[model samples]
Target: MKGTAILFQADQSVTFIEDIEHSVYEEIKSQCGCEHCNCKIENKIVDFGTVSPVFWHEDEIDWDYGY
Candidate 1:
């Protein structure tokens, strides 16, 4: 219900072929839309890579898709 919105894009084919299919993110939060989101990012980190490690709060990510 609350978290961050990391905006980025990537080239899947290139990344996959080059075996460079991973990044190092020093920051991450929830994935839900910013709904009254009180996200408090004290010191957001932007590391190398094309937005590889976009983590979430819980151990597992929650993609609430309308399936």
Candidate 2:
């Protein structure tokens, strides 16, 4: 079984948004080998706002690549 879940961070707090059946979240978590997972079957749904930015660009900016 595979599913997806979303985690939200606001006001210095973390919360689980919702769970979807056989979703991308599950696949990602599984691939990451999450050690603290309880493997519980539960679903959650939340309503929020939707907005899009008007300006965005992709460029190879210099970043601190810790190596």
Candidate 3:
């Protein structure tokens, strides 16, 4: 069965959580600043019979600067 998920970031950490509730895609699209911000939430496709959901960063992280 298809459901909804929420991918949000906070406290310098990113999280992807799955739920049957509302979709957070618009919320993330509206709040995402890519290179400058991290507090956002998005909807991801989840399939229980196939593969699990994974988190992906929009930009590459610079380990040296830790941004």
Candidate 4:
């Protein structure tokens, strides 16, 4: 089965939490992984109380476990 894919490009100049979170989230979810399945963005949230936002793709995550 085809899995979801994620793509991200960080804007180092961005300082606002909302902008950063939304920018990163949008970039990741916008990734077109497979043409076989109809894709959708599952969840996107920003928690200021935590260090960073949690990220995951619908498919098996490779490269880094906690990037």
Which candidate number would show the highest lDDT if scored against the true structure?
3
lDDT of each: 0.28, 0.32, 0.36, 0.33
- On residues 1-67, what C-alpha lDDT tens digit does candidate 1 reach at each position? 3332433323331111111112212222232232222222334433223433243232223448531
* Alpha-carbon runs more than 4 Å astray in model 4: 1-20, 34-67
For model 2, the superposed segments whose C-alpha errors exceed 4 Å read 4-6, 17-19, 22-45, 48-67
Measured by C-alpha RMSD in angstroms, how accurate is candidate 4? 12.5
TM-score of 1: 0.18
Residue 67 displacement (Å), model 3: 23
Q: For model 1, give the 10-residue run with minimal summed lDDT.
A: 13-22
- Please give the lDDT score for candidate 4: 0.33
Residue-level lDDT tens digits of model 3 in 1-67: 2233334443344444443323243433444544333223334442222112223443234449853
lDDT of each residue in 33-62, candidate 2, tens digit only: 233333334443322222111111122223
lDDT of 4 by residue, 1-67 (tens): 3343333223222112221334454443444232221222336443222112234444444547664
* RMSD in order of candidates: 12.7, 13.4, 13.4, 12.5
Q: By descending TM-score, how would the candidates be arranged?
A: 3, 2, 4, 1
After superposition, the stretches of candidate 3 with alpha carbons farther than 4 Å from their true spots are 1-12, 20-23, 34-67
Lowest summed lDDT across 10 adjacent residues in model 2 is found at 48-57
Q: Which ten residues in a row have the lowest lDDT in candidate 3?
A: 46-55
Query: Whose TM-score is higher: candidate 1's or candidate 4's?
Result: 4
* Candidate 3, pairs of clashing residues: none
